[model samples]
Structure formats: structure tokens, C-alpha cells
Target chain A: MFDWLQHFADWLIFTVFNIDAGTKLGTALNFFVYDTIKIMILLFVIVFIMGIVNTYFPIEQLKNYLNKKKLYGLEYVFSAIFGAITPFCSCSSVPLFIGFVQGGIPLGVTFSFLITSPLVNEVAIAMFLGMFGLKATLIYAFSGILLGTIGGWLLGKMNLEPLLSDWVKEILKLKMQQTSYQKEQQTFYQRLPEITRAATDIVKGVLLYVIIGIAIGAIMHGYVPENFFNQYLGGGQWWTVPLAVILAVPMYANAAGIVPVIQVFVAKGVPLGTAIAFMMATVGLSIPEATLLKKVMSLKLITLFFAVVTICIIISGYVFNLLL
Target chain B: MSKVIKVLGTGCPKCKAMTQVVTDVISKHNIDATVEKVEDIIEIMKYNVMTTPALLVDDTICIKGRVPSQDEVFTFLSNNE
Candidate 1:
């Protein structure tokens, strides 16, 4: 088993590093630069497109339309789908949340949006496509949407509105103060500023996280032990999935920054599901995002959100392992 | 002297809340202080605060982890004065 693992790690390292038995150091440096630039440019394009989409779409109208009484399950699914398209992160989602709530969109549907917005962002989608190909990217995106919708529906069924902050409730109460006339009077084109503001805000907000995440990924690509994960996290170990999730909890980074790391892990024989789960947990449920969320959500709701998302990622990880 | 109260964050809700709270507290207390929302990471890094919603008073990190309560703000400014 040890020798097989070592061989696997070596194979992976060679494939990822693009190094032959006797490749020069300059070749390796060249490969790193080429990969990093390609990845970064892809990220920039995707984010820019997402920004344009976010800028052009009128989410408030959509939220209002969805606010009507309907089947909870379907609403949750649609919420997640909508979230996937929106270019907002957790921070940028705040104004949208406020808009949704004031528009009378159910808490659960809003939760779906909240969950999916950060989990299946454009940057992640682009990175996944770049590293894992279109099929894998599509799978991850669809799964994220599924998780977001299901999670939101579950939370909505719990009827946790009473648990909301007094301020939020107050905001809800004053919803009527701004009449629909005030809202409908503004066309989608007129809302460009708001969309631009949200896009720029999200980019600015997550830029550091992305940069740091990518930098870490670059270093891992360059020097982290190839077999480190296989030695520690492989072989259907009972502790592996939970341990990966726990380890990922305190880290505050983005998916784009971590994709290269994920590639490295997969190269080294780290279980596919475990690696993906670790990535999801680290990127989606970042410590900083959680800490920032605490200002808006109560401890109870936050804990529940965390638990639901963690379970989903774990299950997804296990499923990947089972299938792949 | 202008009492400087800095709200540290990358322009998230908590940072916005901290800015509001500081503004509210200063107004309520009628203190002659200016509240500046610091969105630049470098400026925030100078204070060595990693968390958002950090509150700094005249360069001292008054609150590092959580949003300061109204009472806590009162005591902090009072003590500083």
C-alpha cells in the first residue's frame, strides 16, 4: 500500500508540475507562470461577465414576484438557481437580503439565495472549469444549486422568522413605507448604478481573499509535499471527511485561490470527495464570512446554516468518492 | 483635538454597522469626534486587526472581535476622556 501510494503521488506530481524525469528548473517556473496567468485571466473574464449580469438584472423585481404564496420546495430550488447566477458574495448579498425581506420573499427562499450566492460563485465555476473540465464544473455547480435550494427549504419549513433580529423585523415592518410605485418607477436600465455598485463592491470585497487564496495555491503548486494528503487523509478512513471539514472551518479563503491546491491533492491520491468537500467548506463557509454574518444573523440561525451546508458538502464528498 | 474613531472592515455589513454605531454614540453623547470608515485593508492592517467590525479610537484598537454595545461604547469613550 505504501509503495503504491508513493507511486501514485509521484505520477500526480509529474502530471501537475508538468515535469519529466529530468526537466530543468526553468521549465517548471515557466509552467507555473503560464498556469497562473491563464487561471487569473479566466477568473477576471468570468467575474466581469458576472458583474455585467448582476448590473443588468433587476433582482428586486424577481424577489417581489417570488414573494407570492407558493409551494415551498419549488421556491427553494428556484431561489438557489437564481443565486447561482447572481455575482454576489456573502457581503454583497446583504443589500439583496434586505431587498428580498422587504419585498416579502420568504426567509427560506432568501436563505437559499444566501447559501448559493457564495457557494457557487463565478470565480469558482471558472476555476473548476479551468482545472477539472466542463463536466466536473457543471456537476459541482448543479450540486451547489441543489444544496442551496434544499437547505433553504428546510430552514424555511422550520419557520424561524421570529428568531430574526429586532432590527430586521423593524425593517420588515417599514417595508410599506417605500411604495411599489417607487420601485416600479425605476426600469432595469435605470438600476444599472445599483448593479454596478453591487458588482464593484463584491469584487472589491472578495479581491483580497481571492489574491491570498490564489497565492497559497501557487505556493502549494510549487512546493507542498505531493503525498501529504494521501498519507494523512486517504483510504476511506472514518475520520477523514469530518477531519477535513473541521480543519477547513477556521480558514477564510476563496474557491479560486484553493482550486490549484485541490488539483494538487487529487494528483496525490487524496480522495476526490474529501478534497472537494474540504474545498467547499473552506471556500463557502469561511471564518471571516461567518464572523461578518454574525453581525446580521443571530447565533442560532448561523449555526443551523453552517450545520446544513457542512452536511451537504460531506455527503457530496462521500458521493464523489463512491462514484469516482 | 478631533477624536478619531475608525470603523475597520472591507465595507461589509458589520463594518457598516460599526460605523453607524460609532456615529450614533458620538451624536448621542455629543462628543466632538469624527467617525471614519476604513475600507482599505492596508490602513486596517496598520492596526493589526484581522477581523471586520474592529473599532479603533485614536489608533488604539478598542474593539477587535465584535461590535461594541451602546453601553460599552459609552464606557470606552468615557474612560478615554
Candidate 2:
């Protein structure tokens, strides 16, 4: 009777979920379910916590503490560390950037957030671990943090304030208007709904993108040709990094969406550097991300952001190729 | 009826420049039009554009994926008008 009940349950689950019984489809379906649940729940939890932090911590205090121009290097390090822990995409990171700026965080420090947010995220880390193992994931994560810190500090030192749009400057000027409304003054209990609302807003905004990204990733995993990478990007030629970056520019997809493609490339014996470059290009500098960034940044700053990220990805890819 | 032109982006400089150029062109031609900037991603995505710095005139996508020169934009506006 127990055996029969088990069989019945299996049949019910298979029919309802359309899960394959025992094949790659089954494996893929299991992976999808596990990954989706893990990602969504993790995202909700982290964002909720961050939202609470945002609400109660008073970015103003943090900003006031770090506002000295000379301490910009330390601010960059802080931003990079925070960025490494928070798994935000380019589009998702903007609101946080606004929060940081409105909170009076330095431009370069906020830039560190922008830089590391998408490039090295928890989702990317998990996927990297699952696909490429722990060593690669650790290296990628560490390097990403380093890059974010250095890039932000360097840009901060350049004093590119002149390149800012008049409107942004205007917005900055108006920052003093709301200095009195401090959310942090509220008790933690009072801030719960605010945290919930912020998390919900973030999830609502980003969930669609995540679904689309995962769907595309699943499709690529199941359908794309194994040897396609070998045919297109397998050469050890020096120009492949730039070529890959150029190819990735016009396309709009996220890191999760491109991981399956990277897996295929690795499986097909593409050089590690070239494949990493392609992944970074597609994930870090997507068209959608650029479009989203256009709302807050000026053209010159946007161009600089793209250039810096692309160069970093290329360098990282080369390093990976040399070492591994 | 005045034509409405919207520059869609995240309020970045190029997006601002695009808005400026469009406004400049409309004013120079004495065309009765309202130029606005759309910074919301969902609203921008409604037009099926994957790139930023896009221009929309009368709710139609006129230029996409690149920042247009002032003359190019004028020609676009005039041709559409």
C-alpha cells in the first residue's frame, strides 16, 4: 500500500508539474525549481534586510561621516564591500544610488556601488559556483570587489564634477530641502512596513527581469548547440576579447541569462578569458542596463562607466586565461 | 494640436542632451510642441526600445539606440510634421 501511494504521488507530481521522470529534462526541471525558489527567497530576504537597513540607518549620518573629499578612498572601499554583498543589477542599483546620493554619499563612492553591484552578485556567485566551482567564483568575486574599489577611487580623484549635467547639479543643490525628515529616528518597529514596502517595490520592479533572464537561460541551456562557441569564439587570438565585448554590446540580457551560454562556451573549449569577457559584456554592460542608467547619468559619465567596466572585464578575462 | 516629444532615458547626460536638442529644435522652428523627459524604465520599455537616449515624437519612436544630432533631429521633426 505504501509503495502504491508513493507511485501515485509521483504520478501526481509529474503530471501537475510536467516534470520528466528520469532524464535531462527532469534534471533541468529540478534545477530550475530549486534555483528559482532559492533565488527568489534569497532576494526577498536580502532586500528586506537592506530596506530595513536603509530605513533605520540614516544614510545622512553615514554620508556626513564620509563626506570629506580626501577620505573618498575609504568611501570607495566601503561602497565596494557593500556592493559585493548586495546583489543588485544595474537597473536595480539606480534607486540605491539615488538613496546614497540623496543621503549625501560621495559620487565616487556611489560609483563603486554601481560598479560592483551587477558585476559580482550573489546570484552570479551561486551560479558561478554551480557551474565553474568554488575557486573560480572566489577569484571572480575578489577581483570584482578590487576593480570596483580602484575604479571608483580613480574616478573620484579625476574630479569629473564639470562633466555632470546641469540638472543633476540642480538636484544636488536641492538636497538640503528634505534634511529634516529622518526615517532613522523612528523605532525599528515603526520602520517595518517601510521595509516591507521597499522590498516589495524592489521585487515588483525586478521580478519580471529575473523571470525573463531565467527563461532565456533555461532555453539556452537546453537548445543551444554545444559546438557553436568553438565555431565562433574558440581562437586564441588576442583580438577576441575586444571582439567579444563589441558583440556583447548591442545585446540586452542579464548575468543569469548568459551563464548557460558561458557554460556552453566552456564545454566547447573556448578560452576562459574570451568566454568571461563575453559573460561580463552581456551581463555587466547590457543595453537594458544602459537604457536604465540614462535616466540618472549624463552621456559622458555613462560612456566612462561602460569603458571602465569593459576594460576591467577584458583584463579579468585575460588574467583567468593566463592562470587557468 | 501641439506635438509632444519625449526624450526617454534615465536622466543621464546624453538623455539630457537629447532632450535639450529636441527642445532647441522645436523652439527654433517655432513649432508648437511640448518636450518632456521619461525616466521610468517600464514606461520606456512600453515602446520596445532596448537602448537609451531614444526620442519619441507624438508617441511614435523617431530615433532609437543613438543620440541624434540637432540637424538630424530637426529633419526628423520637419519630415514628421
DockQ of each: 0.03, 0.02
Predicted model with the maximum TM-score? 1
DockQ score of the complex predicted as candidate 1: 0.03
Worst 10 residues of 2 chain A by lDDT: A177-186
Lowest summed lDDT across 10 adjacent residues in model 1 chain B is found at B42-51
What CA RMSD would candidate 2 show?
Answer: 13.0
- The local lDDT score (0 to 100) that residue B16 gets in candidate 1 is 74
For every candidate, the chain B TM-score is 0.89, 0.88
Off by over 4 Å in 2: A1-58, A69-72, A86-107, A121-134, A170-175, A182-232, A250-255, A286-298, B1-81
Query: Model 1, A1-324: lDDT tens per residue?
Result: 134443543455566755663444433444345445555556666766786675445665677678875864688888898888976545545445656766778888889988888778887887787666777787788878988987888788888887765666765675244211111233555445444554455456556665555555555655666677777777678678877888777664554566766776776668867877776787678777777656457899788888888888888878878887
Worst 10 residues of 1 chain A by lDDT: A177-186
Error of 2 at B22 (Å): 36
Q: What is the lDDT of residue B66 in candidate 2?
A: 36
**Model 2 per-residue lDDT tens digits across residues A1-324:** 134444544555467767776655654454455444545665677677655543334333445565645662577887787777754334345555555665567777878877887777655665565556667677777878877887787677667666655655655566343211111123566547645755665565556666665555555555566666667767566777888878877655355545544665676668866766776676677677776667667889888877877787788777777877
